[model samples]
Target: MNEWERLRHAMRATERPDAVLDLATVMREGRRLRTRRRVAGAGAATLAAGIAAVVVLVAVDASGSGGTAPTERPPPVAVAPPSVGVSPTSPEPTPPPTVARDVPPPKALGQVIDSGVRYGTDQRVYYLVRVSVPGAPKVTVGLAAGRRSPNGYLTTDLLVNDVEGADRSAGFHQIGYDERSSTTPVPTFGYFVGPAQRIIGTVDGQQVDARLARWSFDKNVVIFWFDPAELAPGKRLDGIIARDASGRRL
Candidate 1:
């Protein structure tokens, strides 16, 4: 479609295959435009709005794809299997660490649910999970806030050391499963774990649980929803979750 057509569809949250974002490149690619400062300013505004609008549209479109890589490298989305999955060939094994150092609770819990990075019972490595809201549309807004490995890579929540008690959890090398919509040990909406901030102390008289030590840089937000579906095989919500004192996702 043409630029006007693409922009209109984007505003309406429609999907466009083979969509290119470089307008200047597009002009250079085949089209042309005025070189005046005033013209450039007008062009930039259109580009900014188009980019912003495309984010929500593309995010909405991609949401149907389901389950993303279960790592902190990128944000998480709740995609189902038959799409995203673990490879048949497992990765090389890594050693586990003990629990994270215990950190005192934050003063208040807002929207963010941070589980501070701490070594578990054997210096098990771990990462802080961050949640945006109770019923995030896709997967929970997750972040990786844990010990940097020898190679300087942050440990994704897959490492077994931190999740040793959570049954046979794969360590950092393992891929992550989007669980924003997945059921938790408790009946809840969306959730996250990390150090404390904005999400802390926002809601009054609220009870928080399963809090994590939340860091500022490692923050993610999700607009989620909750469902009361029965337990699914190969799926379980068993683990040690730390929450803010007020019971919210960081």
Candidate 2:
């Protein structure tokens, strides 16, 4: 058992009091919550791949040719703004030695934006993505999934949303997950970007030519994305978004 669980178990073993029983219940609930989150992570990755395939086929058919096409994108709904923050550097790890590097970064004018879709059957599941547009100002992106509770799904809340292009100067924005903010006992993992290698990233089904801004562990799950213009062969995706610069500029 984990440390938290161990403490609860010890308390229950000694005291017959109702408080001890209550602590045990809390411990069980914590375990259940953690398990649910882990399940969500694995599910999101798999769903992302399936969603990617759907996007690619549609993108190819929409354009005369299969080549990545630049077009109008959907708009983002006006959000009070999830705690969006930029990173001083890309969030992905550096590339391997074998990978070649180009001195001049390629242009990312027209990244294809992924159309809005319910990634999974759950009504609360949705993703917001920004296309890797060439020469576009750094824009913010968000993804929100509703919380599942015994009371049924609570109103869709901002599960995770962070900016991908802020420098060290920019303050950290609210990432929405707070329990993990205080500790690191939980098993955590994330991606990183190394020097000399292009920070290549795949979104849903599209190969985006953007670099990472700030991908980090929000609880055990990590939230990560890249700048639309910074990515090579940038293809911007179109979506209906509020306060989206991709619509205004690129």
Candidate 3:
């Protein structure tokens, strides 16, 4: 067929509704043609370079056959692995909280809750717990006039041991009450003087049951707490009499 007729027939075929065309196909064809030309050009250039290199190598080989070719070669390039920065490790898991343990009660009654001898006072004021027969008349034995609470309220109910028996050079101190107790016990003539110890008081030549403990509020000072309720209902709450670890009365 003639070129004009063939062209007319191809156009009629492309004009059919099912034979759709778009700009994207045209652009893709253009890019493919350009890429092929570029590749062909590069291949021709490479061939020329290879031919030139071969000619130079032949000349060198003919010239060097009378001697020796240099054995030195360039070192191979090192390819490193893909780098990945290390993320900081998550913070250590938080630790659990601590729990408090239970403490046991004392075994002996009238045991000195706490006591200490200070050398600087003649008539020193010491905290004490006083206990005796319920109906027996209470006597003031060198008891202090009054000790106000820390909150500035005059404590009329404060039980103290007024030490009148000590000489001018020394004084004794103690406490036999738990300040944290819900119900207050009757103030007795006793105070904390040690961690745990026995207080031996004879009544009718028999031993009394009293317990004493020292609650350390800090390193330098401690409060004394005591329990005499374990004493026989009929047994008198004989005031706690403190003594040194050597068994000598303080």
- Tell me the TM-score of each prediction against the true structure: 0.20, 0.18, 0.24
Residue 202 miss distance in model 2 (angstroms): 62
Question: What are the C-alpha RMSDs, in order, of all predicted structures?
Answer: 22.8, 25.1, 42.6
lDDT of prediction 3: 0.34
Clashes of each: 72, 40, 24
Instruction: Name the runs in model 2 displaced over 4 angstroms.
Output: 1-21, 64-250
Q: How do the residues 1-250 of candidate 2 rate in per-residue lDDT, one tens digit apiece? A: 9998788666645643223347888999999998997788668766776676678788777973343323333597432112232222223222211111111222211221121222243232222333232332232333332322334343333323333442111222222222232211111111222221222233333443322222331221222333323222122222111111222210
Q: On lDDT, who's better, 1 or 2?
A: 2
**Model 1, range 58-157, lDDT digits (tens) per residue?**
7779784322222123467432111111111212222222222222222212323222223332121233343333332222223232333444333332
- Alpha-carbon shift of residue 122 in model 2 (angstroms): 52
Question: Best-fitting candidate, measured by lDDT?
Answer: 3
For each candidate, the alpha-carbon lDDT, in order, equals 0.30, 0.31, 0.34
